[model samples]
Target: MQAVKNRNSSINSIVESVFDKDAANFWLQKFNPLWSFNQALGKIINKDQTAVDTVSLTIQTNKKFKLGEAGQHHPVIVTVNGRCFERTYSLTQLDVDHVLLTVKRVDQGIVSNWLIEKAQLGDVIEFGQPYGDMLLPQPSSPLLLLAAGSGITPMYSLIKAALKSNVSTPIQLMYWMKHEADAAFKAELEMLAEKHANLKVQLFHTQSEHPDSRLNESYLNQVSNLENTTVYACGPSGFVSTAEQVFKSAQSFKSEAFSLSHLASDDVGFINVTLTKSHKTVAIPKGQSILVGLEQQNIQPTHGCRMGICNKCACNKAQGSTKNLVNGATNTEPGHLLKICVNSAQSDLTIDL
Candidate 1:
């Protein structure tokens, strides 16, 4: 059974990676310019904590806003203490007139700290239109939702959309966090589980005296059949990377990561990338990231969570070697560092892009 699962996972990874390339390109060409143009300033209605810090915005826009997918994210640009910064937060309220975002302030995090402490009601903030391909599958398909921390924002939107659409497909969610207090929308998820027979929810706390010790092989072994599940995951980069391996082992996993800035480190390395389509050769430098180099050359790769959390920067390492600055680039070890936003080149590399 384990071997079968492994084979299935490998196949799914290949397939999903292919799909990711196509989907990413499509969204990049279609939405990037439009999203850039529709960007506007919004007013804060309220900023408070709901497990973490949640903020609501009342957007002042004359143009019709494009509704985002359940799991999509948008940037919130704000000036705090006179310093301007931008942060990407997932859309919690999908298909709604007003915008809502929930975030946890990491120590020294410029934007999060500003949003949590100083942002006043009615304060104007810059924001862009909805843009992301990490959307939920069609309502007809069975769903497997996984999340941790603020990553739950997107899943919350998915569940709400499913309920609003009167979806009947079987949906199972496994949410793992450090403590119960850190779990967002627990009551809401429980309420949905009670209201809908097709929806099943599971909460896993790593620190609690629970049956499972975090999400692992055992926890996955007990989940429903993987053959029919479409997996979605978000959260810390390390957590997301670990979960992606587990899900890819059992089912098809679609992931969005939100950790990037914190992963930058002074790792001396070099890699060669031959852009097949561009017919160009670029050498990635030590301590510098591939995405940074690519962006410098006017190759604006699709990215969110420029800090390396969002998988938007995931690229195929067609040949050569690289190291993931985030999560230690485990999968890329033999030769497959996924996200360039947080990874450095170890040797000459070739990418399908």
Candidate 2:
């Protein structure tokens, strides 16, 4: 298998040299983009018609695809309304060549709605490498998977991977959502739990007639055997925060939130932020990072893993002072690269966003 994988790599390298992506895809896709082995060039194979407002896409990629951890996300790019959007979606590998990406349409979710309503089969989409560390750790032990809303995407992956890998450790899943229909992978999760004796599944419908409408302290206290398990939660900030606090005494606990938390708000007044390339100036709030401020003003800058882990949101600070929220380090140098996801406007700044 190692030799076969090596041979496949050699073949892709040879193909990249002979058949240039630019010459072929220029007519196929304008301004031919990089079609590298490290990238996921996927074509939508199918969509769940039975799925309601949320849509699940099955994408088929080539053998050169980079495999992702069970609880990681891929930054997928799709062109919608003449604008390209890079949104991160947790990927569930159906096979070596296929993945399932479930996107829920939010009220103001430009990309999410576009994907569900407009994206069609055979449409091509580019994806960054799968990333994030919220997976079942090696040498598995008892695990509890807590998820809400779209957070089920990654937790689903983790559960399937755990069972597929033949890990005998028990996996307890408690998924929270507004209603039964709102649960994206309800059917598959039930099947998985039924098939794997070691897997347990529970659902909390926050707005439905079902019991248990929340994942709060009261619910957390009733959970059994949590002391010996690793708790993994993914969802909105509030859900994750609650899980963190509730499971603090567990063996281990981790979480993934869709959005980054803003630094503590300060009354430092507005700061001038100048976009060097666009030649536009905007007044950003005192504590708000440039990324959040830009998004508020309808400026969609390319970014992924909004946690400053991926360099997707990194930009050049040609001239200005910026403070990194992750480390609280301030950079006053004229020309330096900084991650806008965690940095805020420290002064009148010019950035190549």
Candidate 3:
């Protein structure tokens, strides 16, 4: 009885120490935008060169690491060559004490270069909270998933979750890539298809020697039973545009464009924007972007894609108007069509950031 009582007291003390207010406050720094998570001194359990520009990193997390849902991304913060950078990578798999993140090295991308070249086993790093709204559909509904190149990262998580749950719903995944080398997760995808009978996949190769064509309207038409399928896409701007137009025209399709910009040829032009809320006026130079101008004034807003596609930088245009830099569409509507990333101020204006 004495031993049991002592053990209980010891456990209580440890728990109290871990969850004390001061500890909570310290741990909270992990989620701040300016700050990042503390290194837990975990070894890189696994790593894989998933594709030409993509790699996977698996890290063992300590007890303090928070659990994140599938389809969310974690902001990885690292210092490469004395330059600190933060980049979000999709979580490919989740376990009780570890996380698998698949990252693609973008051309001249600061963070990607660092992770590929500098990140190694036992290296301490920090990260921010997981974010994003993309998630798996209900188990009862069929899903149509499309991905291009590294955009396959997020879908891997969703598929893993569904397979783990033994979902009865069907999934049709179409992956588009330039070449066989650029197709990451191919072996894993094949294994998944072999394991899950309800999962179907098609590889769309734009530069293939064979007839496997790029994702287009005709290819979409070839797929049967699309009207009942919920579409989810992540890819380059052109690919997303083509996919969305085809699916939205024929069936219910929702898409998430991982690319930064999705501006059309005619959307490029200068225009004016007014922010009625702050009463601040600024001129969007002919060649300057609204985002850069706003940042010059130290006005920061929620953004993922710095280009016009993600719509995260959409500000409320209380009054006045602006024009798209890539398309000729003019935003005459005061409260509608506000994409500050690509829009330029043509006249004197105010903005609500």
Candidate 4:
């Protein structure tokens, strides 16, 4: 609501009338990101630790917030040590008023560990718009949804959305994990499978006693309609890499690896970078993200979900070229929009940073 947006100014006017203008904006922006425009926000009503180092957060989302697409992720912002850190979490719509976010704590994951170990009830978290192309294929195109480890989160969303929509698209989900006991949403998936005739689930145990039952030719041979299926896969990079090779013959394929590999820069030297807004120049080291390089010189650009999913770190390239660290894509166009967290300076660069 425009009135809600104006609420800050109204309160600021009241505070400024009594106190000072600087105090109003300072304390407002410090307490809440909503003091600014185009910011997302949510409140955690409940959180469930479903597994070891894994959490499912049920957020009471703002009424003004636009919901995310099935299988897409949104930014989750939290405050620690007075500094806000943002990370992306895949969204699963639970009801009209609430959405679920399942997060897995990664090694040295600052935000993830905070959510797991420190967050409490009634904590309000800021967020950004949801993004990612991990969605259901067309109804005419059959689906093979492959997931591993914590990658099952988005697959869970995709499967549930399709089933509820009652489309005739046949879906086969093959979820693999280290062990059956370690899988998330196992019972829920089974129940969904039983309720929907079009949904079929195949669970594989990678750490089984007999053998390493990872996805392979044998698994591919057992799945139906491989030739007709459009594939969606998510997992660890190694597992996703393996699934990509096995499903090479599918009609079409798309996948999201949980982590991106660090690539060596071809140019073994620093590139001159000009922060357009700051009007500052610095040498961005090769293979270092524009985000990190900026942080080195105390140029803190706005960012969220540094993994390149939330697009909060997106900045326009006024000039020069950059390379994407995630997908290995390259861009050289003037005014090109790129995520600084997962892109490196490829030439003398001018950014809207």
What C-alpha lDDT do the candidate models reach, one value each? 0.70, 0.80, 0.69, 0.80
Instruction: Compare candidates 1 and 3 on TM-score and give the better one.
Output: 3
Ranking 1 against 2 by lDDT, winner: 2
Name the runs in model 2 displaced over 4 angstroms: 1-21, 27-39, 260-268, 272-283, 294-302, 307-311, 314-339, 342-353
RMSD of 4: 5.5
Give the residue spans of candidate 4 off by over 4 A: 1-41, 138-140, 205-227, 236-252, 263-269, 316-321, 329-336, 346-352
Writing each residue's lDDT as its tens digit, candidate 3 over 1-353 gives: 99999999999889877766555546664553223233332346677787887788887766545546777766666777786665667765556777886778888888777777667876655655666666776535787888988778888888888888788788888898888888888998988899889998777777867747777677766567777777877876667767777787434665555544545433334445445665655444554567877777676556645545446688777666566654445676666657777676655556676
Q: Evaluate model 2: give its TM-score.
A: 0.76
lDDT of 1 by residue, 88-123 (tens): 877665334566667776778888877777777766
Can you give the TM-score per candidate against the true fold?
A: 0.69, 0.76, 0.76, 0.76
Q: Whose lDDT is higher: candidate 1's or candidate 3's?
A: 1
Tens digits of per-residue lDDT for model 4, 58-136: 9887655778889888777789879988777788898987888888888898888888888887787877677888777
Candidate 3 at 172: error in angstroms?
A: 0.7
For candidate 1, the 10 contiguous residues with the lowest summed lDDT are 31-40
Overlapping backbone residue pairs in candidate 1 total 15
